[model samples]
Target: MSDTAATSSRRLPPANGATLGAMFVAGAVATMAFDLWGQILSPGLGWATLSPHGLARSLLGRFGLPNGDFAGYFVHFYLVGLLGYPLGWLLVFRPAWRAVIGAGGPWILPAALYGLALWVFAIGGITAIAGLPFFLDFTGITWVALIGHVLYGIVLVAVLRRFRLG
Candidate 1:
């Protein structure tokens, strides 16, 4: 059989466990790509860096929080990022038509958490543990960080339907 015919005949997920896993991985990778690309164009595009300190101060200032220091902002920003991380999941999982994870909340939460856990673990383990700051340091703030992740989620969904990934 020709390679083209064989490729076309390959069985795809009929809305089950494996498809869900694939979707989440695709989303996470999209996010990683966004980060890398954002940093690459940050200088020329005049985009703000995703620095923790800058993010903390911007958020605090918006809410009128008492944080007049950079160090304080950095710590608080990390906590804020963790808490709001699920928002990206909410955005991505809600629009999905298939229920590979089974039930509404079960699959959604796991998918979202899976993407988040993988990202944080990858960033910490690969970047920090492996001492790869020269590359990851491009995204040290939250404003641009949100842009990257939001774009990632959007691209993830778009790609799935566009290419019939499921």
Candidate 2:
């Protein structure tokens, strides 16, 4: 068979259980790092709305949950960890998809793009559904969110690398 045929015919390996778990932990850490950054900057930046805790509070409140700051913490970490599962599983097990996305190189760019997409979905879709104004304004909160997302991407990439996950 030709090289291309052979490559195409090769099946991806199974997902590494340890890597998958590590990825989830990495995601949770990255998310918390982003939220911590937001909390640190929100006061001086005058963008308390950018706090993950605050956003989670609003989202939980919308669903009529006991939406305190503590509850928001759980919600934020849980969602972040949950989001990591698919990303980790697919990338770790599916080499073809990873190659297609150029994940073999430095992961910062793709991961940052992923973070930006998450921000768009959160502010544009989730916030809109919660009856809040969409992320139309490029204000401090916008900057905060953007920066936080980038930070999250950076941390996620770093942790994944440390864990030797694809």
Candidate 3:
């Protein structure tokens, strides 16, 4: 067989339940940590808004739902699990994708990329919908969010790697 045929014939593995679970759990943990980090610093800095929790609250209020920390928590968990599942599956089971991710040397590098992607989406998509500012202000909250996202990615990848999940 030709090299092209050989390469094309390679099949990717399907993600098992455990791998998916790991991804969701990792995402939850990371998001929780990120939120906690924001909460910790929010008191000191005036007008400092940390994380997407505020956005979630705003969205819930607009929708006439009971808007508060509960809304934020619900939305946060929803997004984390929703996004994490597919990302973990692709990172683990897709050969071409796996190769690209692995090429980054340390797993954290790819995880950082993932975090950046999430931040961009959250800032651009979620914040816009929630009527929140989207990376427009250079504030302490913004800086903390950036760092938090990076940490989220690092932790997510580390957890996945540790469990050999994806």
Candidate 4:
């Protein structure tokens, strides 16, 4: 077969359809986290802002972070942001098998760590260690975001190397 044909007929990476579906689920969960924060947590803090952005800003203020008005959390902080990353890769780069397996493995673990770190830092001041429970109330969501972020990050690495996305 010619080089053009071989390139055109190349197969996909090993990451399964379910993994992709899970990625979408993770994204949805992230969005829900933002919603819950906006509706419930922000009001409790007297932030009174009903937007996701508002919730993040209020939380930053609550913790004394310099990142007021920051929007990167949607990508790094929330499960929805988690989803956005994978969804973007799945759609844009069309990940491959080697990339999927190698990247997907560690993706879930580290992403979760990062997500928790962000949360703890965000609320470390006002809540104290005792305040962790309230923030951690969304266990299911936390898992999703963390895992999703992991997958997203790994997939991003994979995509960058595999698909040549700049």
Instruction: Write the candidate numbers in order of decreasing lDDT.
Output: 2, 3, 1, 4
Worst 10-residue lDDT window, candidate 1: 77-86
**Candidate 3, residues 60-83: lDDT per residue as tens digits?**
787788888977767766665345
Model 2 segments more than 4 A misplaced: 1-17, 41-49, 81-100
Q: Write the per-residue lDDT of candidate 1 for residues 1-166, one digit (tens) a residue.
A: 9986563344333356555555555555564555554566554577765443443454455556665676444443333332233233433344332334443343334443434443564343434543345336655433355455455545554544444542
TM-score of each: 0.34, 0.72, 0.70, 0.31
RMSD of each: 14.7, 4.5, 4.4, 11.4
Candidate 4 lDDT over 108-159, as tens digits, reads: 3444444444444433422343234454454444444333334434434443
**Clash totals for all candidate models:** 4, 0, 0, 6
Which residue runs does candidate 4 get wrong by more than 4 Å? 1-13, 48-50, 53-82, 86-109, 116-166
Per-model C-alpha lDDT, please?
0.46, 0.66, 0.63, 0.44
Give the per-residue lDDT of model 2 (tens digit) for 15-41: 567856876777878877787778775
Top TM-score prediction, candidate number: 2
- Comparing 1 and 3 on TM-score, the stronger one: 3
Q: Candidate 4 at 130: error in angstroms?
A: 36
By TM-score, how accurate is candidate 2? 0.72
